[model samples]
Target: MRHIPNALCILRMLLVVPIAWLLTAGEYKATLWVFAFAGFTDGLDGFLAKRCGWMSELGKILDPLADKILLVSVFITLAVIGVVPVWLAATAVLRDVTITIGAITYNALYGYPHGNPTVISKINTLCQIVYLLLAVAAKAGEWAPDTALLILGAMVFVTTVVSGIDYVVTYTRKAIAASRAKHGLA
Candidate 1:
């Protein structure tokens, strides 16, 4: 029972490869369906974890890790196939990379920098997922307009940059405070 959330997370991660393949192969409708299913699993897992008390340390790590894998993979694939702007994909990828490196450095120096996603971070994730969905849907069946995509792309770009900076600033402040506490400097 408690393992269900973690299993869903693994499922989402596994779906990433198929999603990328579908996108690359010009199977946008199929890709949209698979991608939407994958997104649904993300919400389901989170709900089960919170509502059923199925949360665990592994889930804590696995949930967001799965999201990162899916988003980064999709962004890169979209860029490769010319469905999305390359700079947007690059910005999204670089932000993740920067955060990963920051997390590693903070863990090495100040123990695991413990925290939850900020509100901005959550909005950023939502924006990215929505943007990708629209991009795929537009290709799949002309379901979205170009102007809508342009707006979403700009939202994605803003949220990505803002959340990346937010994480770095928030974590850096935490690390600094920890150092001060360790040194008894108030």
Candidate 2:
């Protein structure tokens, strides 16, 4: 039971290699289905972890790490394949960079982790999936899907930037509180 989350995380990581292979081979259709499966399993992992009381400290770290690495690598690969626009990929990846830095800084200063996913962050993730689907579909040379990809990319870009700011502010406050406590002033 306690291993469910780790299993899912490992599954997500394993899926990434094939995703990269599919993209490199220009198999967007296959990539679409596999990517969707990975997304579905990602959600299932967290739900089962909570429902089955399978959440461990390692799971706390591993689940999100798997998601980040898999999704980030996919976005980068798609950009390299010229299926997704470089700017859109940059926006999505930049938020990841900001969140990672903030997490590390918060841990250093506060001696604890400070966040789960914010609503905005979840919205960003959903938008990213939409963007990926659209981008992959666009590789089939359909204009309508390309339009949707453009819209989804814009939403992802906005949500990602918004969530990045939210995370930095949220975690910085916690770090500041910890600093004050260390000085006996909190």
Candidate 3:
């Protein structure tokens, strides 16, 4: 029971390769099913971690890593196949990359701050997932509307930029405070 959350996270990571392969092969239906299963594991892992007290340091890192891998892979593949916009995929991927770098820099300078997702960040993630699902479902002949995609795409872009900037500002402030404390200047 203690390891269940981490196990689910690991499983999600493991599913990335096959998901990517399916997307590259233009198997949108199979990709959608696999992605849905991966999404299920994501939620389940988080629930078990919080409700069952099964959280761990490793789980903290692994869960987000798995999500980033899955999302970025899918977005890039979709963009490459011309199913989704390249700019949208690039924006999503860049936001993750920027946040990751900020986290690492903060850790190196000020020790590990618990990397909790902010409300805006969570909303951003949800938008990205919803957009991806729409894109995939549309590709699979599920009748996703063009206007809907356009609206979601705009939401995703706005949220991604906003969240990325929020993270940068938050981390920069924390890092500055830590530096000042270290120098007896706070």
Candidate 4:
């Protein structure tokens, strides 16, 4: 029972490669189905972890790591196959890279962060996932409209930028406070 959440996360991570491969092979419908299953596992894992008290430190790290790999791989593969716009994919990747670097530096200088997701960060991730699903579905069929995709893309961009800035600002403040405390000034 305690291991269920982490196991789900590991399963999600394992799904990343097939998702990317499907995207690359232009099997948009298959990609969408696989991606949806992976996303479902993501939500289930988090729900079980928090609701059932199955949370562990490794689960903390593995869950988000799996999400990042899945999302990043899908975005990159879609961009390569010309289903998703390069700019949007680049923006998503850049934001993740920036956050990763920030976290690494913070951990080295100030010890590990609590690894909690902020509200805006969570919103940004949701937007990204929604936009990706829409894009993939559009590619899989003609159901989604261009106007909707445009609007969703714009929302994703805005949220990505805002959340990235929020993370930097929040962590910078934390780092500064930690430094001040170490110097006996806080």
Query: Highest TM-score among the candidates is held by which one?
Result: 1
Tell me the deviation in Å of residue 45 in model 4.
0.7
Root-mean-square deviation of every model: 1.0, 1.7, 1.0, 1.1
Q: Taking the tens digit of each residue's C-alpha lDDT, what string does model 2 give over 96-173? A: 888888788777766658368889888888788767866776775544455566677788888988988898888777
Q: What's the distance in Å from true for residue 38, model 3?
A: 1.0
Q: Highest lDDT, which number?
A: 1
Q: Between candidates 1 and 3, which one is better according to lDDT?
A: 1
Q: After superposing candidate 3, which stretches have Cα over 4 Å from the reference?
A: none
Q: Locate the minimum summed-lDDT window of 10 residues in model 4.
A: 113-122
Clashing pairs in 3: none
Tell how far residue 3 is off in model 4, in angstroms: 1.0
| CA lDDT, every model vs. true structure | 0.93, 0.82, 0.90, 0.89
Off by over 4 Å in 1: none
Arranged by lDDT, best first = 1, 3, 4, 2
lDDT of 4: 0.89
Estimate TM-scores for all models: 0.97, 0.92, 0.96, 0.96
